[model samples]
Target chain A: MGEFDLITRYFQRPAKRSPLGVGDDCALLAPAPGMQLAVSCDMLVEGRHFLSTVDPARLGHKALAVNLSDLAACGAKPLAFTLALAMPGVDESWLEGFSRGLFALADEHGCELVGGDTTRGPLNICITVFGEVPAGAALLRSGAHAGDDIWVSGTLGDARLALEAFRGTLELPADVFAQARMRMEQPAPRVALGQALRGTASSAVDVSDGLVGDLGHILASSKVGATLDADAATGVIAAAASCGLGTEILRTCALSGGDDYELVFTAPPAARAAVEQAGKESATRVTRIGRIDAEAGLRIVDASGAPISQRFGSFDHFV
Target chain B: MGEFDLITRYFQRPAKRSPLGVGDDCALLAPAPGMQLAVSCDMLVEGRHFLSTVDPARLGHKALAVNLSDLAACGAKPLAFTLALAMPGVDESWLEGFSRGLFALADEHGCELVGGDTTRGPLNICITVFGEVPAGAALLRSGAHAGDDIWVSGTLGDARLALEAFRGTLELPADVFAQARMRMEQPAPRVALGQALRGTASSAVDVSDGLVGDLGHILASSKVGATLDADAATGVIAAAASCGLGTEILRTCALSGGDDYELVFTAPPAARAAVEQAGKESATRVTRIGRIDAEAGLRIVDASGAPISQRFGSFDHFV
Candidate 1:
């Protein structure tokens, strides 16, 4: 079949949420009245963002999920998206699996597949997501205050642990490995949690490149500092005890591991109750792990309140 | 430098036109109060959409220009765009040239670069563009009627001639080759022509594929057929005479060659004056090549009024 026919067969669907869909030159979208459009683009390349042997269905889900994480961080409701894909050649089975995974998540979020282009080349998937948020309501990394409580939703470091196991640097029980691999392959973006914490959270970011590194973005953008509680941070590492990991290894992964896709946010102490309520409403666990500070750099402190000088680096594509 | 730093240094600029730009998780766009947002995406891969030896600046321009052509076909005015780029390594000089070409056209069209991702991989460029048009004013391919006149903007076939020479299938004089090569390397998207024809043309499509193939899309969408004038079509080949091409060769290239980025539109006979006025307002030449018909399939007739049955196929990547 031709390239266009392939797209029509696998990717094109009736766009219920968008004004116009795949058949047209351009898809049309009308934002809710008095709302602003939130747009973000993310590209995934084979052997870099994903493994060559990765399942097509999971890869597709992760591709769109990564872009949706950006929108969730902005507290925007999912609306519509366009995918631009390049592949080495046509593989009908691969396309079928990929589209099924993609549409499943898209349907869950009510995000319509609006328009896109497909061509032959090395495998690459680029997705641009569009959503809407009331003016001035989007949670940004620059809104943190000096005294706000730092919080994180869900868990952290399991994806990184899974990667380590895959690379043969570590080993775990079969059940633990499977669970960790699932976290690595298919991240669930916390859209509802972001929308719930819109007014309550002072500043927010999604943890894509480890907890400390992603949180550093907020600190840099807001021109503030933070003091991460060592014990509290370790408590957020899911499955560490079950996996029989050492404390040092657990701390290293929790602090420096990337691809968690959890929300890290800050709110004033007075809004603590509201933040917790919001988390409960979204069915995501909220953990208070630190506090924003007036100082200029991030510091990790032990139970005795002594500063720890461990370095935690985030994922950098160019590095 | 890290990937984020590279983006900030090379791609980021003061986004005066957009509500929010690069630093945020999602760029914020607020379309004109009564206008609808039009979105289109196009992807370019190394050794596929372009030659590896091509100038980086031209490649950047073409990547965005192709997507803009889609917006133009929908009669949408440029607003903003997001770029997702992947590369094998960090090359400072390459990035400089690319961003320069990209921004030059963006500045001319007032389309702001808002938000995107940059990752390390094989070279790939994908751009998603956003535009705006008044409600119900877009020129759609399904709007053509059986009695409408078909018109094309700008000359055709030069780009195809360039490709043929590059592929060693044809030879031309240096000057003719240079002119044809320019057409293939840098196609000017018919943004103005499309915007001007919003209310005048019955249906419109940008000529990325061959004229016959792209025009067939309009026919299929509108459930109509067409009769192309062979002599009139040959006259639209801009540099064929200078290149010493035969009539048969001229006809083949003009009708079946792609990458024109021109506009092929149809309007009723009564709207002929309006269509001509649009072409004048847009400062683009318009040529009448055929007429839409009540018949079920396309037909081409020579000056002697004899039907030509030879086949002309358009470029299809998968085929």
Candidate 2:
């Protein structure tokens, strides 16, 4: 089939909220008055972002979910998104499974597929998502203050543990591997927690990279450093129980594990109860594992406040 | 350099019109109160969309130009765009040239680069553009009338000529080849003309996949057909003068050329003068090439009104 036929069969839908949707040269969107449009784009490539052997359905889910994580970090309600997909050739079952996964997540969030482009080439999925946040209400990485408490929503390190197991660097029990693999394939974006923390949280960012590396972005933007309690951070890894790993493994994975679509945020110490309430309301686990500091660089500390000497580098595409 | 550092050095910039620019989870934009947002996306894959030997700077220009053409077809004023690019590896000179070409066009239209993604993968560039049009004023492909005059802005076929020459299917003199290659590399988008024809035109579409195929989209959307004046269409290909091509070659290339990023539109016969005035104001050449009809499919006829029998298929990625 041709590109248009492929689009019509898989992606086209009636526009309900926006003025126009698929089939038009350009989809039309009008943000509600007093609302600012939050836009973000993400591209996923085989072997780099996902394994070639991954399920097509999960791949689609992960592609859109990653973009949605950015919207959640900005505390923006989902509106619409454009998908640009490049593939090797036509695969009916792959397209069906992929669209099913993509639309399931989209429908859950009320995000419409507005417009997109499909081409034949090496597999690449790029999504540019749009969301709406009220004027002056968006939570940005620059909003954190030195005295704010750093918190992370949901669990981390499971995705990285799965990667390690998959790479044969570490091994897990069969059942444990399956659970970790699920975490890697399908990350639950902390959208509700982020929306709930809007006015209560001082700053926010979704952790796709390692906690320390992603947190460094907030520090650089907000001009403040952080002190992460290594023990407290390690305690949040849910996979630690089933994996029979050492404390060092747990700490390293939890602290520097990328691919965790959890929110790492900060709020003033006085609003700790409010942050806890937001987490409770969103049905997400909130863990306090760090604090913003006036210092210039990150500092990792044990329970007794002593420094750790080993350095766990985060994932970087190029170095 | 790492991905973050690459972004910082090349794509990061402070927000002037947007509430938030690069250093955040999402870039925030607030469209004017009465304007509706127009969104479109296009993906360019290496080997499929362009030649490997093409200039990197021109490749950047062509990528954004094609996307902007979609906005132009919708009669939307340029606002902003996001680029998601994947490359095999970092090449400083390539990035520098690409950025230079991209920013030159972006600055011309006041379309700021708000956010994007970069990764290590097979080269691909996906751009999602945002434009704005006053409510109820944007042109659409579904608005054509049975008796409307079909028009084309600027010349066609030169880009196809350049392609055929490069493929060794045809040949041209050195000067002629160079000129045609420029058309192939950097076909100008009819942005100003589209904005100018906002109210005067009945329906519009940018011709990327040849005149007949792109016009087919208008016909299908409007539930109308058209009789294209093949002679007039062939008369508009400027490359004919130096290419030493016959009538058959000119007609085929002009009607089925896929890379010419020009506008094909329709207007009522009474608005012929107004269409010319719009073209004049926008500094573009306008040609009346066909007429919409009540029939069910496209018809091509010579100057003598005899129907043409040859078939010229348009480009399709999956076919």
Candidate number achieving the greatest lDDT relative to the actual structure: 2
Compose the digit string of candidate 2's lDDT tens values, residues A174-242.
887888888899988788888899899999999888998899889999999989898888888876675
Docking class of 1: high
For candidate 2, list the clashing residue pairs, or say none.
none
Pairs of colliding residues, candidate 1: none
Compared with the true structure, model 1 gives a TM-score of 0.98
TM-score of chain A of 2: 0.98
TM-score of each: 0.98, 0.99
Tens digit of per-residue lDDT, candidate 2, span B1-319: 8898898887776667777787788999999999999999999999999988878889989999999999999999999999999999989888888888898898888899999989899999999999999988999999999999999999988899999999898888888888888999988899999999999999999999899999999999999999999989888887657567887888888999888999999999999999999999999999999999998899999888889997878888999
What's candidate 2's DockQ score? 0.91
lDDT accuracy of residue B59 in candidate 2:
90
- What candidate 2 gets wrong by more than 4 Å, as runs, is none
lDDT of 1 by residue, B104-163 (tens): 888889999999989999999999999999978888889989889999999899989988
